[model samples]
Target: MMSDRLFVYGTLMRGYDHPMARLLSSNAEFLGTASIPGRLYLMRHYPALVPSEDPDEHVHGEVFRLHRVDEVLAQLDDYEGCGPSDQRSEYRREISQVTLDGGTELDAFVYYFNWDVARLPRIVSGRFQPEAFSG
Candidate 1:
C-alpha cells in the first residue's frame, strides 16, 4: 500500500524559511520528529541522505501527513529535481521506514541522494545545520 506520509531532513524541515518548506507546512500536517537509519552529507546549501545499514547511523527529521498527496508530491518532486521532467535528477524519492520520537515505526516517503558522495563531508551528527550555509 502507498503511504501518504513524508519524511524531510533538510530544508523542508520545520523552522526553515524556504518557500518549499512553507508550501509543505501549508499543504500537510506535521506528525512529529522522526528518524531513519541513514548517513547525511553536505550538498552545498542543502543536505542529502543515504541509506545506511549501521544501526548507529541515523538521520533526524520530521514527518508529515499529506493532505493532497498527488499535488504535494508533484511539487516536492519538482523541487527536489527528481520529477519526470528532470532528466538527470540528483535525488530519488522512495518509501522508507522511519521511527517517530515516540518509538513508532512507519513507512514514509523520503528523498535520497542519487549521486556520488565520496568527496562530500558527512554530517556526522545526523542533523543538518542550516546556519553553516548562511552568509
Candidate 2:
C-alpha cells in the first residue's frame, strides 16, 4: 500500500516540540484527542505507554494525521536506529488504534520505544502534556 498518514502522541506533542516536526515540513492535521488505552509513564524525560489491563487508566495524547509519509518515515527510522533489516531497536513504529477524546478511531503509527523500563531513567509521571506533535 502507499505510504499512509501517521499520528504521534508523546514527545512529538507540542510544548515539548521534539525534533520530529521539521521533517514533516507542513503542518499536520489535528484530528482530535486520542488515547491508547494504557498507562503512560515518563521515562528519562520521555513519555512511554505501558499496556495495562485496567480500564480506568488511559494514555492521553492528541491526534495528528501526518502527511509526507515516505520522507518522514526515513528520518524516523534513522533516529530510532531501525531500517528494513532491523526491527528490534530503540523504537519500533507500530500501527495502533488510538482513540480521540470524543471516541473517534483512526489508524496511526506510534513509535513505541524498545528500551527496558527498568533500565531507562524514569521521570515524574504525568509530566509531558501530549496534545500536539509540533509546537
TM-score: model 1 vs. ground truth: 0.95
After superposition, the stretches of candidate 2 with alpha carbons farther than 4 Å from their true spots are 1-3, 25-27, 119-135
Highest lDDT scorer:
1
Q: In candidate 2, what are the lDDT values of residues 47-104, reduced to their tens digit?
A: 7665557766666766676666667688877865555657557667777777777877
Candidate 1 Cα RMSD after full superposition onto the native fold (Å):
1.5
The lDDT for every candidate, in the order shown, is: 0.93, 0.61
C-alpha positional error of residue 55 in candidate 2 after TM-score superposition, expressed in Å: 2.6
Provide the global lDDT of candidate 2 against the true structure. Answer: 0.61
Query: Per-residue lDDT for 1-135 in model 1, tens only?
Result: 688999999999999889999999999999999999999999988999999999999999999999999999999998998855564699999899999999999999999998899999899999998897678
Checking candidate 1 for backbone clashes, the offending pairs are none
Q: After superposition on all CA atoms, what RMSD does each candidate show versus the true structure?
A: 1.5, 4.5
Clashes of each: 0, 3
